[model samples]
Target chain A: MKRLPVNRLSSRTSSAIIWIVLLTLPLWMRAVGSYTELGTQVVVLALAAMALNFLLGFTGTLSFGHAAYFGLGAYGAAMTIKYLVPSTPLAILVGMAAGTIAAMIIGALIVKLRGVYFAMVTIAFGQVFYFITFRWNTVTGGDDGLSGWHRIPLNLGFTTIDIEHDGKAFYYFVLLCFALSVGVMAFLLRSPFGRTLLAIRENERRARFLGIPIERHLWLSFVISCLFASVAGALYALLNNFTDPRALYWGQSGNFVIMAVLGGMRSFWGPLIGAAIFVVLQDYVSSHTENWMSFVGLFFVLVVLFFPRGVLGIIRRRTMR
Target chain B: MTQLILFNVFNGLIVGAFYALMALGLSLILNLSGVINFAHGGFLAIGGYLAYALIPFVGFWGALLIAPFLTAFLGLIVERLLIRRVYGRDPLYSLLLTFGLAYIFEDSTRFIWGAQSVPFQVPDWLMQPLSSDYFFLTGYRLFMVLLVGAAVAGLFLILTRSRLGIRIRAGTLDLETVSVLGVNVRILRTLNFGLGIYLAGLAGVLAAGMLGLSPTIGTSLIMPSFVAIIVGGLGSLPGTLLGGLLIGVASGITTVFAPSATEAIIYVMMGLVLLIRPRGLLGEEGRVQ
Candidate 1:
């Protein structure tokens, strides 16, 4: 149900168009008066929204505190590079591990709950990390945020890629990660385990009747979703060479949820499209006015009222006709 | 040391009262409407700012009495226009709607009032310490406690005794039957949302007197109220009230020993309550899953 494999022909064609636009984005972005970094940012945030959709769209879990893990990923990566090692890849691993581990613990606590109660508990749990980061200023740099740490170059034993100095190389690097992450997610969504998740989403009572071990599957989905989000978080820290407590705040979580929803949470590529629009709009808005937040808020209200089905969802409906 | 502890305990109680007040309002909307009301803090800010604006024209006492009603009026309109459309839909839309509303409220407040903290004056007599020995006892603090107590009592009485209150309680339990029984469910929900916003507005004015008026003031209190609701028990008003006070006291007690853990301790309490009673202390049994 994630997609109509029945519509495989059309999906393949559209996916081809998607890849073509993304792969050559760096080349044409200048013509559009945008930089490669913005492209990379869209890719990175798209990855995050997609990860959130893994749980939210597929499993029907409404988690509202994913930013905690994302922030954990960011802080973990930043800390590793600043204090222990300057290796970029290792830092990403450490960040992912930190976030995923925490998710495992917290996911267990929330798996039994359904719907809004689950959402509320996740939100409450998220603040624990936020408070820790905000209060542990000595180690975390507190409110000033973690800075002075930079993304290091990648040495593949054959050649050294200067990620720090070359913007194009870094953009390619992030795009590569995005491709790999989405590929894995797509593959999983097509698998048997994935169908089980779909079952739970469609009808939890029926899924339980089939002995799908509902809570266990949910925990796995939660952990997987978080792992992907944390990876995006690491990339985000690399993108900026800075991490702040704001990364873990619940507001950031809301942004991710909106991205997924606005993109068409039911579709695989919906979040990516949503992320692109959101990132570009946000970049444009913040630069133009101090009241950018209100504008963004207005966007949300309008979307909820008018475009709740999202761009992809509407497109699908039109195509079906 | 005794004086210091006592002062903090009392201080915690005041803070707890604020949490209880806000949480009670939030709970009302959540139970009946199924909207998380993320913009709640935004409405709270509106209430505080409304009072601030009114104080210049009407004086503090008048603003205190009038601001919440004004805020609730705004809330009723918002519910009628915006929130009503999303009723019977997924909770996600309402949450996102309110989240956006929160952003508007915070930014608008900052834009209008200037982002800096604004002084909201109380009367001189209320500011005076009652006695040298119990110097922390100010008339204003006492007044806040008494007003909150009355409000809480009034709320409980309205639910149990009044016709509208009983209707609201019945609606919360089952909306279909209530609607089938000839109760206008639409008006009921609108009124209920107003009641919730009214509580938020009242909390705002009281909070402004102690914390001063700031765009972020409502946000700062919103989480504690959330924690209070969870720790007390979901769908239970008295539980929310107790949760607020309990967490307030817990944080207050923590401040005496490990000052930094005050905020963290509340979450810790939430975790403990979850572990021991997954649905919360006073949460109804069926609500657990």
Candidate 2:
């Protein structure tokens, strides 16, 4: 494999600088109390986008229905709090478990189809989930969604924290999770398995000939990506304090794909960039015009036509030069 | 029970014709350009809307003639500018790109025509009953059945007999070789795309009268059209026809029995088919990957 000559230290230092700058901006906003709620929502969306990036950017598998897992997580958390347990920790765990299981089941069937088939199957499964949520009014509340679901209070043996009462505290908790997930993802990408996944993406036939179990690798990547997505979903539920079937809708899934692609599917932090751009655009556009969806659609067309590689791709090109 | 079954079967075939039209275009584009064309439904929506728009001024026949050609021209531009660039790249790029285009088209339609369902009335002349007996059917539906059958026959004749069809078949068979042999493969591809869109437009015009026009109608139709293409073999016209009829009948019967599970029935059938024969009923083996 040909290696590009790039300085490790400078990159690490710059990443740290970027992290510090990003982390402080939220704190700065909170201090000023300007658009703090919107800031938290952006952070949550960024986490979901980053999770999608794991498969889309790193593994080169485009999933049009990742929101299935996202919705699963949200519902799992919401249901857990509603029915059995009200502990925040327990709800989060339930969300993660639900998402992982759903991913594994759907991944097994869908991972068999390559490229377009795979994308289509995932989309169908997402639709199935959406339909189930919509029709099963007893559980999911159908279209109206589950409301009045109280937030779980965080209970550590030493300290009990009520996240609902403190928006700043909840924001920090989400930020911490985002940081941890991104860290783990970065580590995985640097590992041997990550390199192998890239190899598979670049040339699946070659990878298969080299004795790599391509199907198993893809299945594993799909499950892992869904797990990350579910965690984001759980956080989103916490932030919104409600869960709905809309979380699993095809449009929501498209939003995730748009974010990942817009920010730069090839870049490590492209989804984060993409999520920020998407959420901000939605915020701005919806406020200005009733036909905001058309504008968003226009953005998608422009991105596809002009920037095939995404925002991160453009950045990499400039930096490489 | 016999009367009910016959009625459902007739209804199924009517719907099936529309599905066949949409799936045929999708399958052709997939075979020739290696694109599944997520925007195919968008073009279908355009056709439906165009027909609706034309109903006030030019009547149904005139709208049917003008709308599909307009959509075909739009498809030509899409192929020339957007789809052509990504032919040799990863298939996912085209999928994502087309998906974006679908979003844009759907949203643009919503913006132009409000989100409310638009009314499209079948012409009074075509609204008469075909037979006054117990086995009742409308003239418009009979007209649709004949129109689709004629369209299919016309498509078949062109593909089998026409000079352009020969070039298209040649390009589909071996693109690089055909290009080497001095045929402009790109032009054939664009023409194929135009033809596909034309079919979608025609289907849309028929559907707008049968099923009301809504901006989101295309989104709902796209998945079923995909199922039809996959179940039929990708790029096989006869296979698409068979797939479309099968799905339409299946859905129609399910709707009669369990209306709530109507959507799931198609996907369940797809899963079952995949399990039994991954290449689909008429799909050529090893072409699917």
Candidate 3:
């Protein structure tokens, strides 16, 4: 199928290069005057963006409130660790489950809406979780944020890695998770179901006429993307050893969409690249000026006006020439 | 208890009026242009700040009348300059552009006015309670309701009676046909956008008085406006008006009983509306035009 522009061989070669570059990122990050935490953040946020891309770039739907599920994952993991069990794997699973369940419920309500209406409703619905986290203060820590919880070290049967202290170890762990998630995403994108989503994106009327169950498929795509976003959120909570209502805020959802768009929504790995630039720029800007928000907003304006096609899109077009 | 219920309901109506005003603008743009205008709240904050600045010179009533006009002027500029560029493109670009504008607007407001909440002055007589039995029925509140009522009535009149309003309604239903018939669509859209922003500005001025003047004011009120549009049925302005009031009263009542669920209650209504009437309470027969 001629879905993505790049052929199978180039895709393979790019993936190989990407894996090598990512594996060695921790080592070179310091040489480039960045920390391991930044790399880990890029990985986590990229995953969220990619998850969003599943629906946005592929399914042709706009959801401005995916952060709700992401926050749910974060809270689910943090709460699981702090209140239930301290196991990392179990916490991740719980976080994923919580996010998936929330997505299912919200997806059903929203599947019928399209375009801007869908975007509006998703954003409005997103605030429900934010309010819950903000108001259910005693449990979720309200606006002050969920504090007192820390990411515990992972213990495996063969060996226990002290991820609590060693940032590099944690980075590698996050990279592994990123790999697994992206791998699943890529595999699915090549599947018949994935093609159906792409078909929907390309032409909804045609896809509908092909006997595709529109709302049901949309719900599935929404739930799936939320699951992925929630996993990223889970990773985010672990990254800070903290969780907050801000994680689920509508702005965060906007960030994910921007990342996906900034990376080139049509390209599978585009959001990762977008997340990297965004994280680095945000880090540098905030450290330098108090009016960093203006700069960030300006960045959005510039990107939309001049670079709507994104970095990867530019690259692909150039290479095509 | 009845008095308390009455107080909350009235307060909710006032709040709902604000949402309806904001939603009406949002819906106006969405119906005609297909852009979500995420920066609308930003326009609102600007209106409040403009009124705040003008109050020294214009007085309370003058500021109320002038601030929204100034905001509409700014909206005209924004529509002419920034928003016009993104119009024939994917809906995503417009959404993002406005989203960015929102960020810029909020940050600039904070930068200029300071992040702290400034007290908005209402004339002393207007603040007085109208009667002992319904002490909560303050004159200022009644005036706000009347002002909002007038604005809604005026909007309806324009849409039905005026040439520009008829053009907008016609453009909304069939822009191509209207354009082919020799209407200046670009001008129509710009005016329509200004009209929407004018409502936003008015809401901003009133919201400043009631909610306290703050940089965060725009962000806080925006979501409910979106909810109002959704619940009211996407294309229909009257539906948006009803949706805004319904959610407002619902949230208000919830505040009286389960105060924490006040915001949550509106979203619950949205969910129920979507399930029961997917097109919304007054939503048109199909997906958004």
Candidate 4:
């Protein structure tokens, strides 16, 4: 009957508290009926942002063109359902696979460059992808994007759930997927591979000298990040029921960078918070003013100048103190 | 076919001049401040809009002369207030900060100018076309090419022979070491930034005549300018010129031949160059490697 160590107990209790709180809130919000779609949007974006955090926070790599992977996932999922299979699970798998392949190819060449050159090369590659989508009018439907896409259908042999018919149900489906992805990411981060990534980010030359395969780690991180982004993209397409070429645009890629920075780059949960704040602010401000772009710009400037380490960083410092 | 090629060449030369002016400014600022100055495009946009505003009062030539100076003054203020704080920090921080500034500048321009395309008229004197039996070129375009050539030559002389230019170059090569030797490094950095902005403004003015003044013009031009810099090798003046003309010619010719793949052509060129020489065509070995 000896008392468990305080640190272990505190950690276990905190995780229990977090899960209990998260589990109840969705149910409580569902009772209120207003949080369904908003909750789903948050979940999807948070998932995407978390994927981005893997690269930005853990690996110290800033990608200016991650939307290419996101768009690839969305397009891949949609195309699979349209052409080969209408099964939701298969489509998602196809989307993730496509994203992984694309990332492996691009990341191999790009990971060699460092700093701003790396960022610009990614941007350039994104533009190349954008141009391909725009030019391949028959496949992608060009700039207009492909619509009339079907939703992911759940077929459990005996029961079927059409996701598009119920927003709350679809929200739950996405939330569940997000939870799985987050769990996977958390596990990966806690693994030895994740420790190696952190080590490489801290001192790449030192890591290389210590017998770490630096390039392989970077490529793996890039591919894994891309896979997560693609999953988010696939879910986003399923939620929206449409896919457009704009998804692959450089501006879209820039948005991910903005989101990553807006959330504290130093913390795991920062990008999720960043995405939530960004999406909410954009929706609110654009509704009120035609000059939303200017307002967003002003906000961005203030964020860079005053809160350089971002909101989470500020919070962490204060909490630590 | 010959006429089309000639037209594209002429167009490329004129566009290349604007590219050179913009890239020259960017290179100078990069050398002096060790920052990419992503807001360089915003300064160009301001010059175009300012020229657009001044077109009615002082006419195009007068506006051309005055607008860039005004934009340079704005650049000076930006450097003093925002850029100076993050001078010795990580390069990524500066890049992100300038990117944010670029967004602010771009959106502010849209808010002020109402997001519509502003018509920029070439002066009546220079509106005529230079024609031969086989090919024709616009008089204004030809003028722009000559003007940019003279400006390049003037800049070269100033940097190589003039006392101020020598100090600026000395400051660029080794900022702290030169500062310890009693040179005013901060002032030189400010001047370099101002000159860079001035060149951007000049490009904007020229662009107003060719592409017409618009808020979206900066967004469109920024990528091409970046492509020129990357292809020519960063921080090299001559490289900027070579990169700009190469891109301009390639883009123009590609548009003429394969309209659908025009946007793709720049990236294809960048990829080919990166494959062969990752540091760029004229980039110093191990400079950006």
List, in the given order, the native-contact fraction of each candidate.
0.67, 0.39, 0.72, 0.34
Per-residue CA lDDT of candidate 3, range B26-97, in tens? Answer: 999989999999999999999999999999997999999999999999999989988998888888889889
Candidate 2, residues B226-265: lDDT per residue as tens digits?
8887677655779888988888888888777787776777
All models, RMSD in angstroms: 1.4, 2.5, 1.4, 3.1
Please, what is the whole-model Cα lDDT of each candidate in the order they appear?
0.92, 0.83, 0.92, 0.80
Error of 3 at B141 (Å): 0.1
Can you tell me which runs of candidate 4 are displaced by over 4 Å? A1-35, B132-136
Question: How would the docking of model 4 be graded?
Answer: medium
How do the residues B1-289 of candidate 1 rate in per-residue lDDT, one tens digit apiece? 9998999899899999999999999999999888888888989999999999999899999999999999999999999999898888887888888888898989999999999999999999999999999998999999999999999999999999999899999998999999999999999999999999999999999999998889999888888888998898888888999999999888888899899888999999998898788888888888766
Docking class of 2: medium
Specify the highest-DockQ model's number: 1
- Interface RMSD for all numbered candidates: 1.0, 1.9, 1.3, 2.0
lDDT of 4: 0.80
RMSD of 4: 3.1
Per-residue error (Å), model 3, residue B76: 0.9
User: Judged by DockQ cut-offs, is candidate 1 incorrect, acceptable, medium or high?
Assistant: medium
| lDDT, model 3, position A258 | 89
Give the clash count for model 1: 0
Error of model 2, residue B256, in angstroms: 2.4
Show where candidate 3 strays beyond 4 Å: A1-6
Error (Å) of candidate 3 at residue B48 is 0.8
* Model 3: residue A144 alpha-carbon error in angstroms: 0.8
Chain B vs. true chain B: TM-score for each candidate?
0.98, 0.96, 0.99, 0.96
lDDT of 4 by residue, B1-289 (tens): 8788878767777777787789888888876777877788888999999998998999888998999899999999999998887777656567667777777788888888878897897798686776765345667887888888887888889889997788888877777888998987778888888888988998999998998888877767777777777888766778888998898888778878888887788888887887777777887776663
